[model samples]
Target: MRAAVLTGFGAPLSVRSVPEPRADGGEVVVEVLATCVLPYTGEVFGGRRDYPLEPPVVPGPGGVGRVVRVGPDATRLRVGDLVWCDPTVRSRDDALTPDIMLQGLSSRGEGGARLARHLPDGAFAEFMRVPTENVHPLPPEALDDPARWSCLVVYAIPYGGLLAAGLEAGETVLVSGSTGNLGSAAVAMALAMGAGRVIAPGRDRAALDLLADRFGRRVRPVELTGDEETDRDAMSAAARGPIDVVIDLLPPAAPSSVTRTAAMTVREFGRVVLMGGVGMLGGADLALPYPWLMRNSVTVRGRWSCPRTANVGLIRLIASGTLDLSPDRIRTFPLDAVNDAIAYAAAHGGPFDRTVLTPRAG
Candidate 1:
C-alpha cells in the first residue's frame, strides 16, 4: 500500500510503500477513496500549529471510503459498502468520559495520546484500518462522487456547534468569523437547518459579499470594523431582530475580544456555543461581563468536535438537497500528489473550495 508518511514535524512527507492494514475483531479496513486536505496542512506539517501528532505516521484526519474488509464483530456493514470513515475516535473503554483522538492527526491529553498509539494511521493511504464504530455508511449514490460527500468532513464541525447551541427553526443565528472555511459552512448549515436568518460577521468584505450573494436575503453579511462594540452592534442590527443564538468559530489568531463581541449580541436566554481556537494558542482568557450574563440569563457552553451522530445528520442534510455539494467546489488530486494537494488546499482555502486526494486509482 502507498501512503504519504510524515517522518517528523517540519519534515517533508515521504510517499512510499507501507504495510497494508487488516481488520481485527473490533475494526474495519477501508479502501481510501477521497479525503480532504485541510487548509492548515502546511501549518501542521511545519510544526506551526503544534498539533500533538507524533510523526512517522500517515496524516489525514478522515475521508470517504469503501469497505473492503469488515471485522467479525460487525453485523450490518459488508464489503464494497460506501462509507465515511470518521477520524474522531473515542476510547470505547469509557463511555461517559472517553479519551478522544483524531486518527492520523492529533490527540487531546495524555489519555488521547495513549489512544493514538493504538490507531496511529489515518486515511492518507490506499487502505486504512479504523474502529468499527467510527465507520458510518453513506448513501449508495455517494459512490458516484465520493469527493462531493467528502465535503461533509468540513461542514460537520459547524453542525456540531449549531447543535450544541440548540439552534431551532425560525431563530436568527449569528456566526462569528463567518468568512473562514468552517465558519462559512456554519452559515450554510444554519440556513439548511431552517434558521430564519444567519448573521455573518467578518473583516473580509469580499468573503462577506460572497456569502450574501450565495444565500441572498436569508444571509446578512456584516463587514466588521475591528472595533469590538461596533462589530457587535453591526451583527445585532444585521439580524433584523434579536440574535437568538451565537456560534463562535474564530481561529486562534483572532482575539478573545472578537468572540466576546459576537457572543454579547445574543438575546436574553439565548445560547452561545464556543467551538473555536480563540484561546488555545495562549492569550487573555475570554472575559464576559458576569452581570450581563446573569441578567440576560445567557447560556454559554464549549464544545470540542461534533458528536458521533453528527455524521448521520450531515448525510441527511446533503441527501435531502437542503445542503448543496456542487462538484465545482471540488478539486481532485491523485494520492501521489499529496504534497501538491496540501499546497493547493492552503492556497484555495475559501468558503467552499475543496481539495481532495483520491488514493485509489480509477
Candidate 2:
C-alpha cells in the first residue's frame, strides 16, 4: 500500500509504499475510501509540536472508509461495512486519566506511545487499523451520497458549541467567518434548528450570495471591515433586539471588542460561543475583559469538539436530510495530491463547505 508520509516539519508530504495494517483485539482494519483535509493539518506540521505527533506521521484526522477485517471483541462493525472513524487515536493513559479531553493534539511522546498501541505498522497505508469504539457504522442513507457526510464530520464542533450555548429556536444567531466550512455548516444548522435569523459576518460576497441562494432569507450577510460602529449598527438592525447567540469562528481577533458589541446587541443573558482559533497560523491577540463580562452577565465559552456523542447526532442529521450538503460544496482530491489539495483550500479562502481526500481517483 502507498500513503502520504510527512517526512519532516514544513516539508511536503510524499506518497510512498508501506505495509498494510492488520486487525487486533477490539480493533478493525479499514480500506481507505475517503478522508478530509482539515485546516489544522498545516499548523500541526508547522511546529505547533504541542500535540503528540512526530515527523513521518500520516497527516489526517477524520475520514470515511470500509472495513476489510475485524478483530475479536469488535462486534459492532463487520467486514464490508462502511464507517466513519474518530481518527484521534488515544493512549490508555490519556484515555483513562484525561487531564483534558484533548482529542488529536497529544504531545510527541504521548502520541508515539498511543500510536504504538492504537495504530499498527502502515496504519496510514491502504489498510488502517482502528478500535471498533472509534468506528461508527455509516447509516444506509449516507452510503448513497458520501460527500454529504462531510458536513457531519466538520459540523460537530459548531453543533457542540451551539448546544453548549443553549441555543433555542426563534432566536437570532450571529456567525463570524460565515463563508468557511464550519461557518457555512453553522449557518445551515442554525436555520435547520429553527433560528429566526442567521447573521453571517464576512467579506466573501460571491460565496455569501451562493449561501443566500441555498439558505434563502435565513442567511444575512454582513461585511467585516473592522468598522466597529458600522458592524454594531448592522448587527443591531438585523437582530432587531439583542442577538440571542453569537458564534465566533474567526481567528483570534478583538474578542473583547466583539464580545462587548455582542453583549450590547444580544439580550441581557445571551451567550457568545468561541469555536475557532485553534491551528491559527497567524492572527492578532483577542482580549476578553473579565470586568465587562461580569458586569453584563454575558456567557463567553470556548468550544472544541471532543465527545463523540455530538458526532453521532450530526451523522443522524445528515442521514435524515435535515442538513443540506450538496456535492458542489465539497472539493475532492486523491490521496497522492494531499499537499496540492491543502494548498488550494488555503489559498482559495474556502467557502469549500467540505474537502475530502480519496485513496483512488474520484
Candidate 3:
C-alpha cells in the first residue's frame, strides 16, 4: 500500500509503500476513496501547531471510503459498502466523558494519545483501519462522486455545534467567522436545518458577498470591522428578527473579542455554542459579561466535536437534497500528490473551496 508518512515534525511527508491495515477487534478496514486535506494540515505537519501527533503516522482526519473488511463484532456492515469514516474516536470504557482522539490527526491529551497508539494511522493511504462504530454507511448515490461527499467531514463539525446550541427550524441564527471553511459550512448547515435567516459575519468582504450570492436573501452577510461593539450591532440588525442562536466558529487567529461580539447579539434566553480555536493557541480567555448572562438567562456551551450520530443526520441532509455538495466546490488530488494536496488546501481554505485527496486510483 502507498502512503505519505510523517517521519517527524518540520519534515516533509515522504510518499512510500507501507503495509496495509488489518481489521482488529471492533475495527473496520476501508479502502480510502477520498479524504480531506485540511488548511492547517501543513501547520500540524511542520511542528507549528504542536499537535500531539506521533511520528511515522499517516495523517488524515476523516473521509469517505468503502468498507473492505470488518471485525467479528460488526453485524450490519459488509464488504463493498460505501461509508463515511468518522475521525472522532472516543474511549469506549467511559460513557459519560470519553477521552477523544481524532484518528490519524491529533489527540486531546495523554488519555487521547494512548487511544491513538491503538489506531495511529489515518485515511491518507489506500486503506485505513477505523473503529466499527466510526464507520457510517452512505447512500448508494454517493458512489457517483466520493470526492464531493468528502465535504461531509467539514459539515459535520458545524452540525454538531448547531445541535449543541439547540437550533430550531425557522429560528434566526448567526454564524461568526462565516468566511472561513468550517464557519461557512455552518452557514449552509443552518439553512439546511431550516433556520429562518442566517447572519454571516466576517472580515472578508468579498467572501461575505459570495455567501450572500450563494444563498440569496435567506443569508445576510455583514462585513466585520474588528470593532466588537460595531460588529455586534451589525449582526443584530442583519438578523431582522431576534437572533435565536449563535454558533461561534472563529479560528485561532481571531480575537476573543470577535466571539464575544457575535455571542452578545443573541436574544435573551438564547443559546450559544462555541466550537472554535480561539484560546487554544494561547491568548486572553474569552470573557462574557456575568451580569449579561445572569440577567438575560443566556445559555452557553462548548462543543469539541459532533456527537457520534451526527454523521447519520448529516448524511440524511445530503441525501434529502437539503445540503448540496456541488463538485465544482472541490479540487481533487491523487494520493501520490499528498504534499501538493496539503499546499493546495492551505492556499484555498476559503469558504466553499475544498481540497481533497483521492487515495484510490481511477
Candidate 4:
C-alpha cells in the first residue's frame, strides 16, 4: 500500500509504500475511490492543541469508497458496495462523548471495535481498513463520481446546524465565508432545505458570481471590502429582508468585523449558528449587539460535528435526489499527489470546490 505519510509537525507528507491492510474481524478494507481534501489536514500538520500527534501517520476524515475486503465478523456491508467511509461516529459512552469519538481525527483505536482515527494510516492511501459500522452505503448516482458525492458530509455540517437551530421553511439565511468549501455546502443545503433566499458573503467577487450563476437568483452575493462600513452596508442591503438564520463559517481567526457584519444582517430574534474549526478565528472576540440580542430574543449556538441523526437524514435526502447537489465542482488528483491536493485546498481562495484524491490503479 502507498500513503502520504506525515513525518512530523509542519513537515510535508511523503508518499511511500507501506504494508497493505487486511480487514480484521468486524472491519472492512476499502479500495480508496475518493477522499475530500480537507483544509484541517494542515492543522494536523502543525499539531493542533492537545492533539498529542506525531509523525509517521496518515490523516484523513474518510470519504466515499468501494468495499474491497470484508472481515469475517462484519455483517451489514459486503465487498463491492459503494459507501461513505467517514471514520468518525457518535458515541454515547462518556469516554468518547465529547465529539462523536472525535472519529476520523484521532489516530488511536483498535481496528474495528472502537471508534478511532486510522493511525499510521489514513484514507490518503490506496486502501484503508475501517470499522464495518462506520460505512454507510451510498446511492448509484453518488457512486458514478464518488468524489463529488463524497462532499455530502460537508453540506451536512450546515444542514444539521440549521435544523438544530429550529429552521423554518421559507426562512432566509445569511452564510459568512460563502465561497469556501463548507460555506458553499451551507448555501446548497440552505436552499434545498427551503430557505426562501440565501445571502452569500465573501471576499472574492468572481466566486460569488459563480455561485449565483449555479444556484440562480435565490442566492444573492455579498462582496466584503476591507472598509468596515462599506462591507457592512453591502451585506445589510443584500439581506434587506429579515434573515431568519445566520450561519457563521468564517475561520476562527477572522476579524471580529466579519461576525459583526453577519450580526447586523440578521433579523431581530433570528438565530446565529457559529461553527467550524478554530484555526481561522483564533480567539477573536465577536462584536455582537448585546442589547439587540436581549431585546429581540436572539439565540446563539455553537456546534462541532454533524450528529448521527442529521448525517442520516442528509444522506437520505441526497440519495433521493431531493438535494440536487450535482453542481459542486470536484477536482481530481492521483494517490501520489495527496500533499499537493491538501495544499491546494488550503490555499484556494477564489471559489468553492472539492479536491478529491483517487487511489485506484488505472
Candidate 5:
C-alpha cells in the first residue's frame, strides 16, 4: 500500500510504499476509495494547528472504503461493509482530559504510534486500519461517491452548533464566510434543518451568487466590502429582518475584522455560535464589545465538530436524497498528488465544490 506520509512537522508529505494495514481486535481494515483534503489538513501540514499525529504517519481525517477484514470481537460491523469513518477516533487514553485530544483533533496516539494497536493512521493510504467505533455503515446512495462523506465533518460542525443553539424552523440564520467549505455546508445544512431563511454574508459575490443559484431565493447573498457598518447593514438588508442566529464560519486565517461584522448582524437576544477554527492560525482575538452584548442580550458559544447522532441524521438525509449532494462539483486527485489536492482545497474549493483524493488511482 502507498500513503502520503508525514516526514516531519512542517515538512512536505512524501508518498511512499507502506505495508497494508491489518485488522486487530475490535478493528477493521478498509481499502480506501476516496478521501478529502480540507483547510485544516493544510493548517496541520503547515504546523499552524495542533493534532495528535506526528511525523512518519498518515495525515487524513476521513475516507470512504469497503471493509476487507474485521478483527475478533468487532461484531458491530462486518466484512465487505461500505463505511465512512468519522474523523475522530477514541483516544487511547480516554481517561485523560478530553481537552488534551484538542476536541477530537487527535485521532491517533502521540508520536510515531502509526498502524499500531493504540492508533490508526488516517485514510490517506491505500488501506486504513480503523476502530469499528469510528466506522459507520453507508447507505447505497453514498457508496458511489463516498468522497462526499469526507465532507461530513464540515457539515456536522455547524449542524451541531445550530442544534446546541436550538435553531427553529422559522428563524432567520446568517452564515458568515459563507463561501468556504464549512460556511457553505452551514448554509445547506441550515436550510435542511428547517431555518426560515438563510443569509450568506461574504466578500465573494460570485461564490455567493453560485450558492444562491443552488438553493434559490431562500438563500440571500450579502456582499461584504470590508466596511464594518456597511457589511453589517448589508447583512440586515439581506435577511430582510433580524438575524436570529449567526453561525460564524470565518476561520482565524480570515481577517479578524470580519468576526465583528458577523456578530453585529444578529438581532437583540439572538444567538451567535462560533464553530470554525477562529484562533488556530494566529490572529487578533475576537473582539466583543461587552456593553453592546449586554445591551442586546446576545449569547455567544463555542463548538467543535458534531457528535454521532447528528452525523447519522445527516447521512440518512443524504441517503434519502433530501439534501441532493449531487449538485455539488467535487474535484478529485490521485493519492500521490496529495500536496496539490491540499493546496487546491485550501485556496479554492468549498464544501459545495470540494477536492478529494482517490487512493486507488495511483
Candidate 6:
C-alpha cells in the first residue's frame, strides 16, 4: 500500500510503499476512504510536547472507511460495513482505568500501539486497520457527504467540552478563537444545543462573516483590535449580565491578549472549558491570572476528547443530523500530498472545520 510516511520530526511526509495491514485478532482492516488532517498534526510532527509519539509514526485522529476484513471477537462490526473509527484507541482495561487514552498519550496496553499501526499506515495512506470497537457505522448519507463526518473528528472536542461543562438550553456561551475549526464547531454546537446566544470573538472578519451567515442572528461576532480597552469593552458588552460558559479554543501559544480577554469576559461562577491550546501545538505559553480566577469564582476545566463514550454520542449526533456539518469547509488531498496539505493548513491559519486525505482518487 502507498502511504504518507513521516521519516522524522520537522520533516515532510513522503509517499512510500508499505506492507498492507491485516486484520489481527480483535481487530479489523479498513479500506481507507477518507481521513481528516488535524491542525495539531504539524505540531506533533514538529516534536511538540502535546504530541508525545515519536515520529516516523502515522498521523491521524479520525477517519471513515469500509471494513474489508475482521478479526475474531470483533462482533460489533463485520466485513463490508462502512464505519467511522474513533480517533482515540484504548484497551478495555484502560477504558476502565482512571485516565488513559490511546495514541496521543502513554498507556500500559498494546491496544494503543497496535491501533496506531492499523490506521492507514499514516492517516494519509491507502488502507488502515483498527480494533472493531474503534469502528462506528456511518449513515449512507454521511458517506455521500464525507465532510459532515470528517468535521465530526474536529467537532468532537468542543462537544465533549460543552457536555462536560454541563451546558443547558437557553444559556449564553462565549467562545474565544471563534474563527478556527474548533471555535466554529463550538459556536455551531452551542446554537444547535439551544444556547440563547453564541458570542464568537476573533480577529478574522471573513471567517466570522462566514459563521454569521450560517448562524444568522444566533451568532454574535467580536473583533479583537489589540487594544486592551477595546477588548475589555467588547467582552463587557458581549458578556452583559453573565455568560453561562466560555469555551476557550485558542491555540497553545495564543496571544496573551486573547487569554486575558477570555478571562475577563467569562461570567462569575461560570465554567471556562479549555479544550484546544493547553496541551497541543501553539497555545502553550498562554497564562491565566490566578487572582482574577479566584476573585470571580470561575471554574477552569481542561478537556481532550479521546474517550469512546464521547465518540459514540458524536456519531449519534451526526446520524441525527443535529451537527449539520458541510463539506465546503473541508479541502481534500491525496495521500502523496500530505506535505502540501500540512503546509497549506499552516499557512491558512487553520483549525480547519475539516481537511481530509483519501487513499484513492474519487
State the local distance difference test value for candidate 6. 0.71
TM-score of each predicted structure versus truth: 0.98, 0.84, 0.98, 0.85, 0.88, 0.86
Superposition error at 330 for model 2 (Å): 2.8
Model 1, 1-362: lDDT tens digits are 99999999888788999999999999999999999988888889898889999878898989999899999999999999999998899988898999999998889899999989899999889999999998999988888899878778788888999999888999999999899988998999999999999999888888898899889999999988889888887888888899999999888888999999999999999999999889778899999999999999999998887999999888998988888877238899998889899999989987888899999947
Candidate 3, pairs of clashing residues: none
Q: Residue 135 of model 5: what lDDT? A: 82
Overlapping backbone residue pairs in candidate 6 total: 9
Per-residue CA lDDT of candidate 2, range 205-266, in tens? 88788778887787787766666677778877866666889887764333445534544556
Give each model's clash number.
Answer: 0, 5, 0, 9, 1, 9
lDDT of 5 by residue, 175-277 (tens): 8878887899889988988898999987777888888899998999888888989888888888888889998888767866788788888989999998876
Residue 346 in candidate 3 has what lDDT?
89
Put the candidates in lDDT order, highest first.
Answer: 3, 1, 5, 4, 6, 2
Clashing pairs in 2: 51-106, 52-106, 52-107, 242-265, 243-266
- Candidate 6 lDDT over 4-53, as tens digits, reads 77777777787888888888887777777887777666766776644445
Best by lDDT: 3
Q: What is the C-alpha lDDT of each candidate?
A: 0.90, 0.67, 0.91, 0.74, 0.77, 0.71
Q: How many pairs of residues collide in model 3?
A: 0
